[model samples]
Target chain A: MGKRFTLYTTIFLLIGIGLAPVLYMFIRSLFVDGGFSLRNYETLFQSDREWRLLFNSLSLAGATTLITVLLGVPLGTLFAKTDLPLKRFFTILFVIPLLVPSYILAIAWFYCLGRSGIVAMIFNADVGILTSNLLFGFAGTLFVMVSALLPVVIILTITYLRMVNPNLEEAAMLYGPWTTVLRKITIPLITPGIALAGLIVFILTLGEFGVPSFLRFDVYPVESFTQFSAFYNFNTATAAAIPLGLITLVVLIIERFFLRKKTFIFRTMGSEKKMLVVPLGKSKPFFMVAVSILVFILVIIPLCILIHKSVSISAYTEAFIRSIGSIMRSLVYASIGATCLVVFGFFLGYILARKAIRLFYAVDSIAIFLFALPGAVIGIGLSGLWNTPGTNFIYASMCIIIFGYIAQYTALGERIMAATFSHVPHSMEEAAQNVGAGWFRRLSGILIPLAKRGMVATWFIGFIFCLRDIGITMMVYPPAHDTLPVRIFTLMANSPEDVISAMCVIMIMITLLPLGGLGLVKRYIK
Target chain B: MVAKMIVKIDNVSKSYNKHSVIKAISLDIEKGERVVILGPSGCGKTTLLRIVAGFIHPNQGKVIIDGNVVADNGKCIIEPENRQVGMVFQDLALWPHMSNYKNLEFGLKAKKIPKMETRKRIDEIFEKVQMTQFKNVYPGELSGGQQQRIALARALVMQPKILLMDEPLSSLDADLSLTLRKEILRLQEELAITLIYVTHDREEAFSLASRIVVMESGKIQKTGTVSEITAYLSGL
Candidate 1:
């Protein structure tokens, strides 16, 4: 009875924590003169600017997705298939961008490309297409996000490609033409993977707040911000989120409809065989040089500039000192958020993996739905939800930002923990019980100790993710408050490139400590 | 006429959804009896053992132990923790996380045995299993034979009345399996515990059990002494 009651408690607590904001949004949307109405949504779509905003957001997301897949699929294939020199070195380069936030990349790119940008001075004339109108509005925002997120697309595609046996490509080599092999055999096998990458990128781009906002684009997030800032109209902002939610829902439905059954069997089967290295041959040098330059310009240069910006002497030493305090506060908030995410995520993972817990599938989907929603929407929903009468418990507190962190990153923790849990057999626990060990003892003394590496990883990843996030935290930040990423954003508007550069270096260094600690812990535990 | 019943099963059955796996069957294990359930692949021998271990509940009937109805169609009464049985899985299922010492101490603490007593019992089990030299080593660090030994010691530390093994030696090599089989037999004799062992190996069943239950398609084909079961197998 106690066990059953605990399960119910876990379930309700999760629903309350996760769904409260979305529910509040719904309630607030309906809160019209003590009655419910769809007027909030109606007001949102009624204006010309709102329609343009919707189109801009949709087009930007669509363009980002298309551009990312174009760059990512080829790069993923090249990374997976070729025996290019320094394969290990390149793999690290490919994944490092994912560790940096898109907004940071946006700031860095803007820093290097703005009128007083380093590139402008270095060239001593109008240099690249960026100096033209390409780096300003929709195209600029779309281009920056693509450059940042293409690595994510590459990583996801690589995971899929890794699952496909290189033997299949090798199998084709003996008979079909190379183009045919690529078009027919290789592409079909990795189609689902490509689709998955594209879908994830689309969803992420749709929800993206940082890059678009920095570009001064009038997208949904920006418009939502305007509505919130100008009119304090929670309803109109939530109405904006309704469209964002529909976009996410549509992606979810489309993915489910097409890929549901296929994913299960594909993942279970594992990769067919080790990659048969497709010799890059004559094209190797050109491809290597080209990719090397792209990576340097896109990732490294911007990061280097940010590090420079952060350390440069400025007029206001006190504001710089206060920035240190802001960094600390951000760290505390993110750490708390990460811990909460990992704990709830671990419990959710345990339940899903146990199979004995009914409603495992439903809970899994709900968790994922919240995860898939844009940070902007979650921020909007949460702000709208809490700003209402009688919800003062969390409205202006650090708890709101922390809640957003959990809602966004809990899926990552669950994924890591569940993968680890499934590897440890259920029979092991049964065996412990059969030997007279009670449930709690068996779990603490045995199961948890065994899964320590995964546990540490869950916390570490969650922490880093929270640390880098600006999208949701920006919306919920109280006046005069600043997280590292938020500070980085503020610097984008006012401070010199080197100051922002210094802050980025600081942020990355701080995040890497725990990541390194996780590695050490994994080794010790193992 | 016979010894006291350590465990009882009354017409217990189980299945997955529509497919009946273990049909209505009843059995009793007397105190200190060494019984082997032998079967071909796909038989319900494993399921029957799992039900007795309290990992799974029977679709019908009851499982009673020491005059208490632990499980019944009316309502299952006892949890696996309270059943006082020790199981060794086909995969060994050694707690890969813990050192050998911790694994042995787990069951003792769960029983709320005194700290000194738990430590003493662990040392004794380690010595008995010849694992004192490797007590600090985790399961991953140990050889298969060593891991199997740790599992047995961990189980035995609980001082269970019944020891259930479900093809515990199936994963080991021939030499390891044979050696471990001898160790199990010796341990059972020393402990004077009831044993309900499940396996599909003919020679293992022949060598281990005083009595053998041969099963097929979730029903017992025959049950008797090993010699009697061999005679039954040969005749079929």
Candidate 2:
């Protein structure tokens, strides 16, 4: 009875806070000012500009998904299933682009390929056609987005590959070479996982606001933001968001269908053997070079360019001094928000893990829907819901920003926690219960201790996401409540190149520091 | 003289999504008796054991342990902790995060045993299992036989009136299985507890059972002594 109460409370609270804004937006789009009407949506369909924005969003997402799958699947398989040299180091480097905010990556590319960039400076050449034409349009947006999102495919694919039963692979190897074995045995087994990863990347890219916004590529999120912020047309902005939200919802449903039957099976069983690693043989060096070059292009070059541009510590100091308030606010708000997410996520995860409630799939779908809603849409919805005439206390405080963070990133926390919880056998807790440990004792002594690593991981991921958020913060932040991402984004149009670069480098450092600390702790413990 | 009844499973039936797994099964167990539930895989032997241990609730009837109504017809359940039952799972289910000693100590501490009494009880069980030297080691660091011993020690330390084991030696090699089976028999005899064990292994069932309940398709086909079971098997 107590457990049921907790589960219902968590589900209701998550729906109330995390999902209500989007629900409000959807309902609001159906009405104009006071009465029920579809004028906003009608106007949305009537405008060619809106249609073009929608096309740009879909095309970018589709192209990014295709490119990511091409690069990520084979590389992920190689790293996970073959004897790739320095696999750990390369995997870490490949994932660096994912950790850096998308806008930061876009800015790095801009600095590297812009007219007065390093290449132009070194060659004393007019690369305006390449920089101005190529780097500021669809091509630059696709490139930046792919680099940032490819890790989703690679990481998830590697996980699925690891989960493929080794016995199946070994049996296939008896009949054919490793390549044939992978095709017949491994790939088919993990196809659902790969497809799920692809769909996630598709939805993420579709809803992405940062890279497109930074590169001046007109997409739905950017259009939605312009409608709300520039034109003060909340109704049109809400309507614009509906198409993107619906697309994301459709993709999320597809992902859910793929995940329903297979999610628990991918969990590592104690009896299952480790993944088989075939020797790379003579192609080892070629594989190593390929991975190294990819990492250099994706991770090392952008970072080096940022470092080169921010050579003066004085520039960093100036940026830091100017944005100290935003930086501090970012840390405080993100920490509070992440802590809340971890708490709520733990209960939500427990419900899913134990199937403690009926309609769990509905709860899961809601989480995914909220997560997949474009940040700009969520931003508009939050303001619409909270920015009331008399609710200034919440609207004018940091509460709104923190609420946005929780609504956006609790899904991430839930995902991490649910995965962790799946590995824990119900029998372990039952064993504890049979030995006369009550619920709290069993939980504290067994489940929490067992799941501590996962909890820590969820917290860190939530923290990083909150720290790097921009769109929702931009829309909801009170005066004097700017976060680091919003501050840097605002300054990019007018700040000196050195200061902008310095701030980007600082953001990278801030993100990397926690990751580095976690790595060190893991090594020491191991 | 007939032994006193310690457990009575009265017309217990269980189902998953309305596909019945345990079909109105009833059994009476006496104190100090070793009752082995022998069945093929998927015959609901483990489910029966769990229902008695209060890990599961039956759909049609009641489980009475020590004259107390523990569970009834899917409506009321005495939680596993309050049942004072000790179970050794097939996979051992030893908490991987703790040392072997801590695993044993957890239950004793949960029963609110004092620090000194808990330490003494844990030490005694560790000594009985000949695992005293490795008490501080985590289960992952232990050999299979040693880990099996730790699982036994963890259950014995609980000092419950009944001990339920579900194919606990199934994962071990033949030699290790023989050794652990002997250890289990010794523990059962020494503890003088009511034992309800589930196993599919014929030799294990024959060796450990004071009475063997043979089940097929969630129905008991026979309940008899070893010789009677042997006779029944030969007739089949």
Candidate 3:
């Protein structure tokens, strides 16, 4: 295919499957009784309870952002730029919670802290009851959200830190101690990346649905989901989601204007020096103990609780018997969704990184904007745009969930692929073109071959995201075709705790299958 | 007459993962001398320079800087900052985030040099380097030649007893390298600083060094005056 045709087709699909539905929802939200109106929004914000919900959303987002950045920066620097031992093991351990869904973590925390929990078995019933009370509130939600999103900041920080030319830090070290050099030179350079991480966490927490809803917190996204699913009020759902959408847009706009050139660039120009690590010397053991303690408290305890809860063979047998189809569905749907996301994301990423079109920046902003919007909004928007009789094929079938995945997660693939594509020298394409190769030929023979590892990584990330995704999948799965995550949510109400915990364990294992497989493949390749 | 000894490396050696990069090589530098260590790439010239500057500790032996044992056996007894050494790295690691003025002010401020003196020193260095007009400009905005000059100025503004240059002009074109070499020679004379430079350029060494040390395979092959090294290389 020609460049222009392929690009326009990508744009059309992006709009058709993603933007158009959202635009339709916004338009429908503006009209009531066949006249243009703002009454849905007015009704949404008029009540004191709604304001309290807004407060809850803002506080949760704000607190998550603040604590994650505060904790993430030092931890990232420790892992990336210091002589802390077992760095790789610690990195993988810390990132495990991120791969699991947030609500699964909430369930794990609930099992550990609920009345009939491990504390009751080990300590006493009263302590378990008090801990249960603590776990079912804002504090619990914030803790889980922090655990889920903290990896985002650390990964970004490590990336930014690796790109910094070590000579700069070395130069600073000549005049001052490592602490001063870090404070004055290293942190200042990577602050833009830190800001970007903070922005992402804030938007994610603001739009988070699964954690708050499971914990019974009154956040705006939960209200949006409750309104649409409970009352089937599409207008009020869209109205309730508007604030998060607007907040995402506004935050994204500021991020684009300020951090676009800084945070997203794959390489720093002219500073391709290697990283230098600080020798911890006598403090090595101190820092090692500190990090191990942190990992134990944050990642190990909850996971151990889940494992302990699901120790019975009957729980696994019953869980597998009930949800075997959903597990298989999760695998199949996630695979298909991941493949589709990567292909479309490749072209969209090409536009963003290479600026193939004049409006390339706008294309990038739109994808990310959609990604950052609460997944519930995208789900409702997909349903509203497709639920009509003419579109029952999509609304009533598996296509709806896949479409929701594309609309919500194309940005993840797009962002990752854009970074991958940016590192391939554009001159290679120019040389191929000079030799009479067409755009499609150059892409297939050169770009795709060169970025094979990156594409694999992008696909893996997409699969993991789709597998653990509850926000979009829960909102839009067909009546009888629920994925494992959505099944977990639906089953949580009346099912035995052991069954839920077993399913959760199954969820984590299925997600880790690809990771472990990829690791083995990489070792085999080596 | 013998000059005062400023830097002495006593049987220093360094290795990475049991692969030796610097063997038992020893050298000494008197105050106010321009000594150039010339060698091929991967011959441990840069490693030895880093050892003397207290950035790297040799596996065996000590480094004495200005009459103090800054590094002994495998420990840096005195840190790099307290050793009063200024360096122009091979990559010219000028702070890209800061303007030239801030770059010049950084070392002085770290040493707790007073604000009035910091301003005075930066102004003096900027004037000396003919970069006064561009003091407020960042390093990225400057040309290759201009950044080289700023790197030199950043090092010199510390007013240290010793200066180390690790092929600071290798990235520039021949003409700019020659120009910066002459500038470096002039500043070394005016400041009467002990200059320890490492490079592979024979002509750069012959032109700038009062004494030359030729090294290969992590050992010193010869140490002599410029003309003697010229003869040694010619015979080789």
Candidate 4:
């Protein structure tokens, strides 16, 4: 009985803290001037411009999804199944784009191909084709967004590919060619994974704010930000965000339906069999060249452009000196947010993994829904909930930003924890129970020690996400207390090109520090 | 009448990172013979069976199935498909996404059998196994004994010249294992196919084998009839 009470209390606390802002926004949308009203929503729908913004967002997301799948599927297959040269290096190169902020990619592309870019200066001619309006609009947004999001598809596809029973392929091999076996058996088995990855990319692209805002394209998230920050109309901003949240919910429902009855536990007890590597034969060179070009476009060119533009060390030093406060604030806030997220996520993940509490699946789904929500929408919700006169402490402090990070990223930590917990046999816990160990004792002695690696990974990922976030922080950050991303976004419009480039370089360095440290630690452990 | 050889393993050896799992083993299987290779776990029984099935290449020898060389000295000279062999894995390895009927039909389709003939074979096998009622069900939906029947039916439906079983009934309870062992014996007799069964259970090996080959530490210790194996065990 005490355990049940504790479980319910934890659930309610998580929901209250994580989802209050969205709920507040929903209630606020239904009321105005202390009376029940839908006037804001009605007005939002009545505008054709709003419909255009919605169309733009959907189209961009669709284009990004298509391009991401086209690039990611073949690449994922190559990495997972073939003996590609320097495979590990290429995998890391492909994933770097995802780690770097999307807006930074947008900025890098602009520096490389904008109206007065290096290409125009090099040719001593007007490169109108390269500098056309397309570079600042849909085409540019599609390019940057696909580059930023393709890693999600590749990584998820590789994971699913690894999980496929190799014996299935060997069994098929007993009656057919490898090609026929893969086509008839392997692809069909992994189609669900590919589709899910594509859907996730689609939703992420729809919610993306930074790239579109930088590339001068008008999407709903950017419009929502404008409604709140530019027009100071909280009602319109909240109303604008509702459609996005609803669309995301519908997609989440579709995902759940598609994944129904499928066991998603990542098995850890089985013998670690190496996946069969198909020799690429003469096509190896072709793949190598193609991959090299891809790496050049995705990773090399962006960093080169940033380095070229930030040639002045004085500019870098000045920018670092000026934004040191925001930089420190970002690290501190992200660390706190990541720690809280991992702790709460461990409890929620344990509940869902063990089915410890009734209706816990609903809690899991809600967390996922919150994670998938657009950052701008989350920002609007948080402001609507906490920006009132009575909530001055939270609204005027860093807690709101940290709260936003927790709400958006706890799902990631929960998933990692759940996967880790699923691998731990229940009999071990039962054995501890038989020994008279209480819940806390079992958790600390057994579960936490076993899941320490997963917890650390969750914390690292949550930290990176919180550090890279711009849209939510932009909306909820207290006045005069900006994070690096917020500072970069605010300064982009007015700062000199060199200073901004230097700041982007600094941002990239800071991002890579933890990742590089992790790499070193892994090597030492090995 | 001359006895025809269905499988020939000549000087086969295999190693993983210099630790030999199969050391210079040789065996010959005749058509319609139930030859059970009995050994403890990690004793190379599965590896030897896999070599005959063309799933693994021998490091220093040749595997010829029905007069055609399938693998030679670490090279798969002819791939598994052309060898016309069916294997039942220890885990059953039934494709969870496929129905029992579809699973049986997959090999036939891969072999390019005609659609009508494929249906006919599948129906006949399902009827023989008394699993026709469960043909539309997935492997996950079936009972363990039912899944065992379906796995056997899937292997038999291919109509391969040779059938290999690797502890396929190890996971079931004692009663179920006994029943399935009897069913498999009955099927082997009815189909008149070559059989290479691997297991560590002494009773299972004795019950299923026309001739039993005892092995330990990657070397065959004895090869004889079931009574001979029993006598050897009694002497030990």
Candidate 5:
């Protein structure tokens, strides 16, 4: 009916679904034996062990950002600015790790480097043991995290490079060589973008529990998850998470106050045909060989290992037979979660893009803060808030997991849809209003139709995030109701390597299906 | 007492995907003269200017600047930097991250101009453009007309053998464009460098050009003195 009423109601529902549980958990943590206390957060940085873990978390995140930036900048430059052959193909090849979960990549690495793995089969047992030792510690964890988060930097770099006005480079060229122009103009211009990428990588790597836990790296998120899952100690778990929450808060503050405005320009920033394509010339062969070696090492070998290990029909069949129910539930729940996220994201993004209300900033901040918070933290918070008998329908059923997905992934949809909605002219809505059309009429007739492709893309992303999600889902999943990623995780320890590989392969393929479908849908929607 | 040619484009042609942008266009720019290539958007005037500036390699042509074969037969014989030219792009294309002073100093440092010389040139150029107060200000913080002046100063500070301007004042308001046009005219008079400016506006060409080359569909239809070009347009 009324626009404000509808908008406020929807936002209220979002707060209820997403923000309320976390707040409820925080409040519950403050009370011990019916007396208010800081008992949960009292030991936030108390001991040497806590300091070590904090160092571990910060160093992992910092190293991941460093390595990914070092690698991604060059690769992103090659793709965005150069006439490198098969640039598109190389881009997709590099992006493969982004589509697959980082933990899955870790698992694949383990199979290839373990004591009885490919290294042993190819070389010798001692070499295999050496590699396995390297693979199971900080080195292994850093490698997996770098590969996983590398795409963020590369994508961001390419996006930022496109925003560099080609004319600027040409003007610089009048004074010096391509190298000079790049140094003097292009790199300096995109420095803000690079910093944003670094911030994102650090935050992501900080909150990451999956890869670190798989590689046996002692980190904050893993510590939080262990405190909850191993000890069943909610106070320590929440306490462990508080440090991460504070870090995320600091990061969010930086992003909102300093970076968000700069980042928004990227939505409008893109390269056109007029932007110069750098000719690689004689150096082309050298770059090609280098890129090929990296591709072979990073992408090809692990993929071949997976295919080689799990090529049997029996493995696929067993994978299917054992996890078919989990796969089906993951699909249904992700679909429902994605649908809910899209609906909520649409309204939130509208408020943001149009600045419909002053509280849009607060809503956006909370959404991003939740998204940036470790999934384990959200999972623990959800369980603490809803595990009572009165809320057993939510706690015991799959609804709590869905709630986790919505809370954790809504920002993905919101930010993307906000970018999409910013492209739509406000005049169209005003014109519809001038014609005496109501809000719903204007929305259905103008906004939705214009924004259909972005909505689909948003839903697809939401679906992918919800599907691959383990941190949130693992903590809250009821008995016998695990999703595919959760099932893959549970099976990793006890199942046959071949079956586990097959399950991972199936999960990857399932993730890719929507990608292909989205491509087709986008191609035709215009 | 004939004019000395400082730049020559011989049978230059460029096409992208078989859609010809510049079709075997040839032009000569004389030393210390203002030549305006006037046409509507997409008439390849800017592309031709870019070719002379050594940014784009022609498919079948040779570009000679001051008796040096800068580009020939789809190959860049001398790179853009070595061409001894400067350009003020249509969008100004000022390096946004750098201060206005650094923007002016960049080309000098690239050429390994001595540090004191770079500073002196920057000061002289900024002072000439009356932008000394904004030496520390970035391009993004400047107004449209101020940035235009800075762009002009950036190009002119190099004291190039040739200067290319591609509709640098088109984005500014009418009053600002008028003022900047006069400023450009005064600078050309004072500096006496060869100028090849591109603009779709005939009035801009008339005011800024000693000679006008009228182009259509990448082909130059008329090239003469400004009065002759005006008469040619009247006949058309």
Candidate 6:
């Protein structure tokens, strides 16, 4: 029961647990051409192909961050704290873009902009004009990524905005007008939240594979995939992962540094829960129209196109049947993975909350390392780890995919659980035990029950990450097995826009229906 | 008549490496005694109380509950749940996720109390606390005073031989704290439970305790009747 012994044991356990895959990768990266060498890094730089791909990936991520912030802030603000007409409707509509996979959006855009496309049809007389030209390459990639990631920025911004106390705004108004208040008080308060949104989007876009890969664009993830899957060069692929991983690490470091600065105060705590709504007045109609257009372009159009494409009788039946089995496999694996994640998340969260468990900084650093590692690196590292002699359990089994899911998604679940756990006072659990509640009883009846909302949030995050995941799944999936995302990605390259559209529509429908039901239940029950 | 030594602390010295927090302190509690640990902030009162409840272990001493040594130097024998001690926190640490009923039932069920017995106990406790109407309400839905009573009922339902509290009313408003202080003393008397209360409020301690143990800077300053302690503390 010595505190030092417990602290050391915990530190070793966490380090070993987190460092296993990375250590495996490091060992593999060392072995080059029958001997250990720095050949991987040397070759990684010498090869222009991989370097270009990394460059393209970073550029696209930066572009996406820029475009996402440009659009998401105004839109998130317009929805949450405004008296604009049909605000709730627009709020739901704007978030629908998140439901549709980015690859599906690419296919939809291809349908509308192809030579015999809808845009071409509408501008038949203006065909071949520069302004009416089809978007592809960097421009098309930027457009699609912005549309894909905008919802992320919007959700984060809106949540933080909702958390800001209106009293601060009221106080600011005493000094000046609404615009000045927004510039001085509101903007400063929301900056950290906005930065968090931007950091998340940047990391996500950096690792993005579906949009860039579909558009014939070379990015780091795609390049890493090509190096391993096409050329079978594991070292080269890992080398490709390093630069992007380093970039993500830098961003994470900066985020943590600024977050620790104590520049921001959480004014929302102990304040009113009801958010203040700014009246739109004459701008209400204009804002409504603009928001409606955004939803149409982002959510509705691609969805409608996919549905139209899927209506063919034979193709629809075949794809639907294939999708059914895929859905089952994904659900089983993801559910098991989510369960494991929640268990670990809750224990660690409780330890941090109650025991004030030391080694948090080291534990957190290791857990989040994978967050910055592109899925390609995870896939490669996993394959290398489990494919070695006598350790082939993960090589062909569903376990590899599950392991990848855990590594990629545990950080998200932990973050969610940690945020909620911090709000709970440890004294409560102590009090329960003071009442003769055993550890299990305290956890089951008191701690777990008190932290249910957080647990639910953890589950939701795990579920969403599992559902939308394509990068790791693609890298590790056994041949002849296809998840929904895999099926959609394959259809992207060969099938017409309609077929891609049709599959997207079904996927979104499956994802959204349960989510909508859950939202409703949460509203009424909790 | 022989007084039952319900709990005993023998040379309980708590330290972190070289820095001793509670230095060689020994105390004993008789059955149904109301003992207040009076201390300035950062004094060793909380640490000593925590050691008795098995939340913490003393670095150089032993804690005996019901004549059994639960914690000794380099030998912590009992986990907190096995201590059969009820604790009320300074913040009235009610389980926010559970209703008053579930919170009360949790401890009993954990000890494998029969379902029927558990229900009976919960009902009786609810009646005792005058919170039967709010049994189904969560901690968030209850007023602070209501929550304070529920927390008390939760601990009492376990029929703990001793109760431990760490400034249980410190977070409440002055008016509410004053009202709850009376409720606590009344409950202690009715339940006839040994109560170890920790607080920095001299007046609150005086009103609720038969004996006050004043602490300063992680050491026991004095232990006596409320009037004796007040006179002693004022002389300092």
Q: Please, what are the lDDT tens digits per residue for candidate 2 over residues A224-276? A: 88899899888989999899988987777766666656755654422368889
Among the numbered candidates, top DockQ falls to 2
Which tens-of-lDDT digit does each residue in A1-526 have in candidate 6? 3434444554454444345765677677878878989889898889887778777887888888988998999888887777887777777777776765677788777776655666667786355233224445788878888888898999988888888888888877788976677678776788888888888889988988888887777788888888888998888777777787788789888977886453345643426657777778887888878888888887778667667667787666666765677767766766776775676567655555554565676566666777666777788777777776676655687877777777776677667777778888777777766666655666676667778888877776676667767888898887655678887786666665555566677777766766787799989997
Scored by TM against the true chain B, the candidates give 0.97, 0.97, 0.98, 0.98, 0.98, 0.97
In candidate 1, residue A176 scores what lDDT?
Answer: 80
lDDT of 4 by residue, B1-236 (tens): 99999888898999988999999988888999999999899999988987886656788998888999888899988755556777777777665556788777766755668999999999999999999999999899999999989888887887779888989889999999999999999999999998999999999999999999999899898999999999998898
What is candidate 4's TM-score for chain B alone?
0.98
**TM-score, model 3 to reference:** 0.69
Clashes of each: 11, 0, 0, 0, 0, 7
DockQ list for all candidates: 0.72, 0.74, 0.01, 0.01, 0.01, 0.65
Model 6 pairs in collision: A306-A501, A306-A502, A309-A498, A434-B86, A434-B87, B44-B218, B90-B167
**Model 4 chain A: worst 10 consecutive residues (lDDT sum):** A262-271
**What tens digits encode model 4's per-residue C-alpha lDDT throughout A130-157?**
6746679999999999999999989987
Best by lDDT: 3
| Whole-structure CA lDDT of model 6 | 0.78
Worst lDDT run of 10 residues, candidate 5 chain A, spans A428-437
How does model 3 score on DockQ? Answer: 0.01
Candidate of highest TM-score: 2
How would you encode candidate 5's per-residue C-alpha lDDT over A1-526 as one tens digit per residue? 4567766876787688778877776777777779998876666566677788899999999999999999999899999999999998998888888877789989889999998899888999999999999999899999889888888888989888887878778878999988788778888778878988898899889988889888898999999898899999888888888788889889878877887676656435455647678889999999999989987877888778888889999999999999999999999999999998888888888888888877998888878888888898899999998889899999999899989998888888888889888877764454233223456655765678767767987888898888889899999999989999999988899999999999999998898888888778768976
**Residue lDDT tens for model 1, A41-155:** 7776688888998898899888989988998888887887777787666666666656667777777777677766777778854674457346778877887888778877788
Worst 10 residues of 2 chain A by lDDT: A263-272
Ranking by lDDT: 3, 2, 5, 4, 1, 6
